[model samples]
Target: MLSIAITGANSGIGLRAAQALATAGHHVLALCRDPDRGRAALADINAHATHPAGLIEADLSIPDSIKAAADQITHTVGHLDVLINNAAVFDQTVREPRFTADGHELFWATNHLGPFLLTAHLSPLLAAADRPRVINVASKGLLSMPRIRIRFDQLDDPSWYTPTRAYYHAKLAQVMTTLSLAEKAEGHLETTCVRVPAVRLDPDRVAAMPRLLRTLYAPKNRMAVPAERLGETYARLATRAGSLPGPYVDENLRPVRAPASAYDRAARERLWSLSQTATGDPAWAW
Candidate 1:
């Protein structure tokens, strides 16, 4: 059975993917930030799960936590066949320039840098596998932002921000960054970016609103559904014929050109260099 490591497995798409993987009998390491939530999620999945599972506590927004979690995964799991960069943050509705303790742009920290560092530190483990895959959950939102250029100074002085901008920026970075990694790996490893549609699937968030409103508006829930229904695509990247490398995929598992700007090789490199600086771990060598 393939050994898989998934971040943000406590809820949303991560949780669903973990569940699907467990039922299919692959060992799943559910990485979460909260121990309590981790244990509960573990229990929920374990009750009827086809495969055994374990939990590793790691807060995506914290660099130190990510490092500790990576160390623990390396020590315990030995290596992984699949690494799903699934954790994310979109809690605010307004433009807000935020930062983690490490002083990274908030969305960039959780959605981009956290996964980049985790992949960097854990790449050896992934490389050790026969045919490994790195699946990054990206979004179609990259199309909306007319102004997206990774400013190295954004780390130094994050100017006015918005929830819309942050979410779009975070996801866009994932797409571009994944492309960069694919280029760097030179096909040594299979890396694919899945462009999920916008969705919501939250209990409280949905219950508070009118049924028609929920159906017509958010439609997904506290978590997004259409964006997530294709969680299987992530599993496909590992378990099925979805192993095509270096392409941004759509909900139907087809390749898509996310945005003309996302293909900028120079910007991709700048983002990579800045990521190396923020995370303190150099990008992996093929």
Candidate 2:
């Protein structure tokens, strides 16, 4: 069984994928910001769990919280085989441009920078493992985002997208940043992102709701895929042989280029440097 760890594992796609991994005889470690909520989410999965999993407390909105989570996973767990960068934030309530306690733009922190720091800190453990894999949960919604120039003057505002552009840009940053880190880490680890096609599990949840709704309470698309399906794609990436590496995967689990901006190396490096500052971590040595 694979020793796998996943963030945002308490709900939505992350939860389902963690459940799937546990159900497949793997030792699953689910990272949640709050243990109370984490336990509630885990009960459903554990009830049907073929292998019980552990939960680690973390809040990606704050870098230190993620760092603390990393410490427990590394020191307490012995080793980590797979790390899924799955937690993300999107909601109409936070449309006004909020900041984490760390003062980072909420979307940027949760969607991109937080994962960057967490992945950065866990490098040694991941590299020491027999075979290490990092799966980042991105969204094909990146296709809908504006072209990210990634200039020194611009990154402070992931706000260019307007109503929801901030959130989508954060996703776009996740893709670009993942690609960049894969190259930077080169021989050390394998990093990949699964671009979510579309999903519809519990659409009324705050995180799942979009900015504009035609009706007060109507679920938009029943035809839209479910979180289980999203988890399937994530699980396939976690367990599959190098079928899709360092690229975005569609619903079919095939490679697809989300946006031209997603491939910018210079932009990636810049984001890396900035993320280093945001996370208050040392620059990458390897």
Candidate topping TM-score? 2
Model 2 TM-score is 0.90
For model 2, the run of ten residues with the poorest summed lDDT:
211-220
What are the root-mean-square deviations of the candidates from the true structure over C-alphas? 3.0, 2.6
Q: Candidate 1's residue-wise lDDT over 1-286, tens digit each?
A: 8899999888767877888888889999999988998998899768767778989999888878888988998898767889999888876433557777877777878888889988998898888888888999887777666567655565546564776677777788888888898888887888888888765554654555566665666533444554247667677776875457447888677888766667889888988887888788555747
For all predicted structures, in order, the TM-scores are 0.89, 0.90
For every model shown, the clashing-pair count is 18, 2
For 65-158, candidate 2 gives per-residue lDDT tens digits of 8888888888756667789999887765564777778777787778888888888777777777777888887776667655654545655565
Point out where model 2 deviates above 4 Å. Answer: 158-163, 203-219, 242-246, 283-285
Which window of ten consecutive residues has the lowest lDDT sum in model 1?
219-228
Question: Candidate 1, which segments miss by more than 4 Å at Cα?
Answer: 93-95, 204-228, 283-285
lDDT of 1 at 227: 29
